[model samples]
Target: MNDVLHPSLLLFLGAAVVPLLRGRLQQAWMLLLPAAVIVAVFSLSQGTAGSMTLFGVDLLLMRIDALSLVFAYIFAIITMIGALFALQVKDSTQHVAALAYAGSALGVVFAGDLITLYVFWELMVFSSVWLIWCRRNPTSMAAGFRYLIVHALGGVVLLAGIILNVLDTGSVAFDKISPESAGFYLILIGFMVNAAVPPLHAWLTDAYPEATVTGAIFLSALTTKTAVYTLMRGFPGTELLVGFGVVMALYGVTYAVLANDMRRLLAYHIVSQVGYMVAGVGMGTIMALNGSAAHAFTHILYKALLFMGAGAVIHMTGRSKLTDLGGLYRYMPATLLLYLIGSLSISAFPLTSGFVSKTMVLEAAALDQRALVWLLLSLVSVGTFISTVLKIPWFAFFGRDSGLKPQEVPWNMLLAMGIAAFLCLYIGVAPGWLYSVMPEPVEYNAYTPGHVLWELQLLLFAGVAFFMLLKFVGGERKITLDTDWLYRWLLPRVVTVAHRVLQRLWGGLLSGLMARLRWLVETVNRHHGPQGILARTWPTGSMVLWVAVMLAASLLVYYF
Candidate 1:
């Protein structure tokens, strides 16, 4: 691959040309761009790291290593899948935006320095938000605005951290930093925001479901996953990530379990899936990092598959609420099967890609003697099973048919989902193909009698518990409040109350001030025809006499 015609650069520049073209040409440009980048990346077997300096700081335009390559490969794969899923959409604006969004993420993965990473980091934010707005609905417009604000805030934090880091260390290398200082902490917090570590996690669930069908699939693949990659690159072994990951895992499961919207449920699971990867990165072992990278790869596949499946259903029926849909399996058997495969993989079921990858993270926790973290991870497995596999498909496709008859999705959409679903099974059945490309060599085995038995037991017993607690766990008509509700609901209510109080206070103050001023004016007017003595103007003669006296004093001083 020529450096001048670097695949990523060519793809990005070519994507910008897509909207100018029409129909088949635009579609070809959109689909081929990611394929070209993937080919170029594969051609370079050994890793390469290089940077360009600007403004006295290094800007890493290209850094090819095993870690980045792993993410880069999946990002490209998901982008291709997304393009296929989006073939039905004739809007060139969306097609180009999706390609640009995908390219920006690939650029970030290859970035060797903080400056280049930041540039693409912000590009990811802006380019992706267009996907949401492409929905062209009021809800999506509002959600996109919120999404922009959240990422804009994250970008600002990231920029501040990078600037402070360059000032403090005189280096812009995007390497791991100790979280013991303010600068490092600032960078960590910025990364955490995108990682959806906590309170900030609301952005994904709030914004993603509002995006257009194909748009949601792309959204599922990039932003948070990029954050995960950055964390793996920049904050591996940070103890705080362990706690952060656990919280996100549990947080995602809880909200997902309570969620009613089909896409929103999957959005919460994104946070949960990333939680596993975050914990793996925090473990910082060869096995754990491999698991993190591999899980992230597979997660993008299955997660996008699930989102595409959901999108297909919504596309036909024009509804996204799970309660509003059911019995779709009868008409769209392919969709049903694909969704099940994705669900099973995401649940870490045996013979699925997730089983092959997620185990390493759990094993890392156990090996590190973090028993509490291990136990929590196990609970998350159960939560994941309940929310995604059992809940999502059961409610969306298997429950009572809502008397809706929609044909199978378009050939291209099904083709994309099929590719992803097949990979889920292929990778699970044969893990070596994926294991070979890991960021680091791993000796741990994914298939073991003990591991299989425990996972089966965990999932089996969780199933039994769900049955036993069916009444408690069943879906409801109510919406569960999340952190976003405070700003979106409670804060506005509080502000409204504050405004009323302030208005009343200001009205009273103005009335009292007006009364006092009126009284003063009346008293002055009564004393001096039109106003007070001081308010009355001096006579012209007095003014002339004062000017003459001043002139005489100046003349006397000059004479003296």
Candidate 2:
């Protein structure tokens, strides 16, 4: 065993053997590999490791630092958690895809140069699409293809940016640069696409709900979060993100409020929650960046927990719509309780992971005196509570009884959710544990009297508003049109119309061409066919008589 190793390589190499193993051995290996990466992450010293030269360019494969370590730590933990959650899956392909996806994310986090980052960036896209495809349904298959096409476009944009950046600066280091050039803007666009920033985020909401039960958990955890890590690494302090982030936060909440499907609702919330991190990163203060990282860390746990609860329901009931689910709490009380923990955590209820983490971003906004930013963030928080805590729990678990009698999910799922839920409470109760791992040091307190009172009052009022507007806020069975409608419906219709017009033009051209050919054939037959004048049996005799008469006429004219 080498003393210095890239954590990604361990998982990537380990995934190759997964399909070869069977039964218990396979599960054990899947679990053990992520655990080993965790150990490897902590064992290594903090500096560039696994540096090499490729095409005369220095490629840094492992760049361990506080920032990278935070993402790597959470990624490793989630991989193990995802593995445990997926233990009962009979398909080897899911496990392989999950592990490989995890590895590629690690690769992105640890990559020190643009080239290395781009390589891993693409790998993440390719590997995670499997999670969608593994569902093997028409919806999943189609969503998978759409997911690939969108990310492929993003990837091409990112690659173009890298090439241009390298050409301009003569360096491929994945460090911050001014957004004054085409390369930088393209790169930022690429990162934002992955981050699920609004207008570019419909793929997440569209595809995630269609994934396999366990695969959704993994999908929810990694892709957007990796994009956050990259943004924090490269585009911190970029002011445009502040606006983008705020819109994302509110946009997600607005849509989630209207969503009818359980997983799609949660998927929308993923966008909403990630919005907080994006805003924090854009703020780019010590506390804000820390908040972004901390929020990302906690978001993964709670979001995964939330997905697990929803997935368990789908797994047991074979239904995911809010209209179809109700009275589940009567049968699955434990799941309900665990899921509530996640709900509280996401809503940033006091003494939960979200409270400890999300407040940092708010605090940063306040300290920076960005009053508008702070106000919007506060409102978004209230919306978060309304959707995830009030709407979701009420409709899915306790609302009008569709008479569902789903039993508790498998113990493995329960265990995974338990671990995540516990961490949510643990981090909230003990904020210092999370604060210590932050990339930058901050002494901000989340338990101040003013802070707690403000949070409580806002949540309390939001709760009141929810019940008052309960009828209006209730999930409808109607499909909400999003930006994807432009591509999925509107654009397709436009193309169909154009295609019909072209088809008519082609048909007319062919008809006219055939008509002219027919006329030419008739003329040729009349002039030269065997039955025509020139081709008759007496043609030679008639020609000779005409020639003698013409000669005699010419002689008479010359004599006169």
Candidate with the greatest TM-score versus the true structure: 2
Kindly give the number of clashing pairs for every candidate: 0, 0
Residue-wise C-alpha lDDT for candidate 2, range 1-560, written one tens digit per residue: 22578888899899999999999999889778988988987676678877888879999888888999899889988888889989899899999999999999999999999899999999998999999999999999999999999999999999998899888888988988667655998899899899999999999999999999999988999999999999999899988899889999999988998999989999999999899999998999999999999999999999999999888888889999887788788988888899999989998999999999999999999999999999998998998899888887898889798877878888988999899999999999998978888899868889998999999999999899899988888778798999889888999899999999999999999999999999998887787786666665766888899999999999999999
Span of 10 residues, lowest total lDDT, candidate 2: 530-539
**What lDDT is obtained when candidate 2 is compared to the true structure?**
0.90
Weakest lDDT window of 10 consecutive positions for candidate 1: 1-10
What TM-score does each of the candidates earn?
0.91, 0.94
Off by over 4 Å in 1: 1-8, 47-50, 468-472, 505-516, 530-560
Clashing pairs for model 1 are none
lDDT of 1 by residue, 381-482 (tens): 899898778776777787768888899999999999999999999999999988988999877787899999999999989888887876566566777777
What TM-score does candidate 1 get on C-alpha atoms?
A: 0.91
Residue 270, model 2: Cα distance from true site in angstroms: 1.0
Best by lDDT: 2
